[model samples]
Target: MASAMNSLIPAFTFILALVTRMEKLDLKVQSSQAKSIGTILSITGAYIVVFYQGPPILFSRPLPNLHSFSVSLQSNWIVGGFLLATSSFLISLLYIVQTWIIKDYPAEMVVTLFGCIFVTILSAIVALIVERDPNAWTLKPDVELITIVYSAVFMVSIRSVIYAWVCRIKGPVFVSTFRPLGMAFAVFMGVTFLKDTLHIGSVIGAVTIALGLYAVMWGKANEVQIIEENVISRVDSSSDKVPLLQNKSMEV
Candidate 1:
C-alpha cells in the first residue's frame, strides 16, 4: 500500500512532464531507449525499497512490521490513499510552476526564500489548527531540536535552492529522475544508524539505482553533446557567410 502511494509522485511527475512537453522525448528518439530503461529500473528499484522486506543479512533481524494493511481495514487506507494522490498531483503541479517561475526570475536564493516562507506559513497554520497542546510548542535544546533546526536550515534550505537552480537549467525531468535514489540512501542510513537489517532486496535495489543513474547521466551527456554540435555548426556556417557577404558588398 505504501509502495503504491509513494510511487504516485514520480508517476504523476512523469505524466505531467509529458503533458507539459517540458522535455520532448521525440527529439531524443535514439536515446529514449536508454532513458526508458532507466526509468523502469529506477521505478522498480524504488518499489522494491518501499515494499520488500526479507530476512536480515546485516546487523540483527529486521524490525517487525506493525502497520501492515489488511483487507479488513480499508477505510483509513482509502482516506490515506486519497490524500497521497492529491499531494502527489499538487507536488507535480508545483514542480511545473516552479520551473516556469525560475525561468523568469532566475534568482535561486529569492525563490527558495519565498518557498520556505510559504511552507512555514502553511505549516504553522496547520499546527495551530491541530496542535491544541501548548506544551508541544516548547523546545528544549536537545537532539531533537537540533535535528529539526539542521533539517530546516541546512538540508531543506540548501536542497530547495539547488533543486530550483537545477530545474531552471535542465528542466523538471532531470530533477525527477533522481527520485528513486532517495530510497537507496534511506536504506543505507537505516543500516548505519538504526541497526536495520540489510536484505537482498535492498542490495539489488541499490545496484539498480546506480545503473539507472548512469543511464540518465549518459543520456544527458549525449543531449548536451548534440546541443554543442549544433551550436558550433551554426557558428561555422555563419562565419563562412560573413566573408561572402563582405565580398559581394565590395563588388557592388
Candidate 2:
C-alpha cells in the first residue's frame, strides 16, 4: 500500500498540472516535443516507484503471508492495487467537486465550512461503522485533535482558497512551479521528521523528476510566447498595410 501511494503521488501531481492548465502539451499546442517530454517524465516516475518501492513492500513483513502462489495472487497484490486505484479516483473526484462548488462561491467560506462539515460527518460515520472500540475516537489529547483540525482546515480550506485566488491573479506557470517546490518540501520533511537516510538513487530520482517538471513548464512558456508573437505580428502587418492603402488613396 505504501509503495502504491508512492507511485500515485506523482500521477496525482501530473493530473493536477493538466487540470489546472499549468502545462499544455495537447494537439492545440501542436508540439510533439512537449508531449514526448511529459510522457517521459510520467513514465520514469512510475517506473522508479514500481521498481524501487513496490517490490520491497510487497515481499515484506507487514502484509499477510500466503503459503502458495495462488493464495498470494488472490489475496494481496490485486486487492492492494484496487485500493490504490480507488484512492487516486477519490482524490481526483475531490478536486473536481471542490473546483465546481467553489466556482461561484467565496472560496474561503466554501472551503472551510463545507470541508469541515463533510469531514465531520464522514469521520463520525466511519467511527460508528468500523472502529472496533468507539471510545478510541475520543481518546486523543485535545492538543493532538486541535493540531489535526488545524492541519485539515489549512490544507483543504485555507490553502485551497488562497490557491484559487492566486490562480486568478498569477496564471498557470507560477502555480505549476510550486509543484517542484512541494517535492523539495517532501525531501526536507523525510530527512527531518522521519529521519530517513538519503540515498544517492533517491537524490538522482528527485533531480530527474524536477528537471522533467521544468521541461513541461518551459514548453508551456514557449507556447505562450509563440501565441503573443503571432498576435503582434498580425497587428503590425495590418497596421503597415493600412498606411499603404491610405497612400494609394491619396494618389488616386
Q: Say which candidate scores most in TM-score.
A: 1
Clashes found in each candidate (C-alpha, N, C closer than 3 A)? 0, 0
RMSD of 1: 3.6
lDDT for model 2, on a 0 to 1 scale?
Answer: 0.56
- Ten contiguous residues with the weakest lDDT in model 2: 54-63
lDDT of 1 by residue, 88-178 (tens): 6787778888999999999989999999999999999999999999999999999989999999987889999988998898777677777
Candidate 1's displacement at residue 88, Å, is: 2.4
- 161-220 per-residue lDDT for model 2 (tens digits): 675564444333334334434544575566566554454444554666666666656765
Candidate 1 runs further than 4 Å off: 1-4, 59-75, 243-245
Angstrom error at residue 20, model 1: 1.2
Pairs that clash in candidate 1: none
Q: Under the 3 Å rule for N, CA and C atoms, how many clashes does model 1 have?
A: 0
* Model 1: residue 16 alpha-carbon error in angstroms: 1.5
TM-score of 1: 0.86
lDDT of 1: 0.78
